[model samples]
Target: MLGKILRIIGIILMGLASALMILGGIGTVCIAWFPENWESLAMMAPYKLIFQTAVIFTILAGILGFWATIKLARRKPNGWNMAVIALLLSLATAGTKMYFSNMARGSVAPTNMRFYFSLFVLLYFLALRIPAIWDKIRFEGDQPDEGVGGLAGGAAAIVAGGLTLTVHLWAGPSHTVNGINYVAYLQTELLAAGVGLIIVGLIPLALDLWKTAVSRHTSETLKIPVIDNRA
Candidate 1:
């Protein structure tokens, strides 16, 4: 019963995030590229590239997230894993924008908020993925999970972690404001988180490898000829 409720909540969150990303992307493109007042936008020309790139990533994440969530709601295979990757990328992409916003204002509060929000989202998603909760949400008639085979989940984690790492690389550890190198404290926080996620991502790979090895051993054992002594 509790699992069912959590599943619904997760779906709601995904839908909300998806809608926000889509609307945000459209608004960004229109405001940054096709502005009503050309002169005002021109004044911000230096940031046009950044805005465009951010919007692209936002839209991509929104689309993937929407698809993944929909699949999960339908009890499709790999949906959970895909959603994990999508959510991570979406969080990282959104965080990058927030970081820049905080930088422009010369305040670190927004970035910190973004990081905290990210941690909450990640924790919530993971809670739902716990085996006990995950199994409870499934109906008896639903297709059996062929298991993740570890590869899909592992790959998703790697992609998500890699994106997080990339964001850290692009943002760097500090931003120069008023000729002072102001270290964005969240930069280090994100870097450490990214590394940890990468390590976590390896679990799927290891699981898959172990499963494969066990399967092969079983197959080889079965292939051995039976002794004729019983006959």
Candidate 2:
């Protein structure tokens, strides 16, 4: 019962996080296209600060969702693995972004550092998705406990990471101006990362639905014994 309750709560938190991600994505995309709009809003410094506060809140909510899932998964083997990987990926991505942001602000050109950090974030995102894919395939009762789904998911992640790395390698370095443009770039990346996270966050809920359906079916099929067998 506790597990069920926690799982439900985790799902709710994950959904909330996903919604925030979508909002953040939309906001970032809008800002990217209309940089001038932000300039005008910049005049209202307090409003701009409020917007920043919202962004931070959104990030914190996402982190909380991930942490909640991790906590709920403590006893469940597969779920635990998924939660741990997701949490680690989230942290690594955040760390890499911070590192790159600092590098972009410093006097020296940290092109290599930036590239590698981006690659690291990409890899972490890919790794995080593995558990989602595994959850999908392992939902069925007939499936063996051989961990095949996880291995397949890991392979898929490897391919994804490789592709992202290729794109990073081909992409040119972003220009920075007083760290303003760097901030914009970081926001853009965060938006993209949020989208990825939103997708991952949805997976567990979908898996839970699938599991509930299976359980209901199984329960309905089971026959209850009475003193006498009656129609």
Q: 1-231 in candidate 2: lDDT tens per residue?
A: 332333343333333332333233233332234434554323334333333444454455345544444433332345434434443433443344334434433321222333343344335334434664435433224534343332223233233333333332322233333434433444555446545644554564466667779989999889686686584
* Model 1 ranges off by over 4 Å: 34-43, 105-119, 139-231
Q: What lDDT would each prediction earn against the true structure?
A: 0.57, 0.39
Superposition error at 9 for model 1 (Å): 1.4
* Model 2 TM-score, all chains together: 0.28
lDDT of 2 at 111: 25
lDDT of candidate 1?
Answer: 0.57
Determine which window of 10 residues in candidate 2 has minimal summed lDDT.
Answer: 163-172
Clashing pairs in 1: none
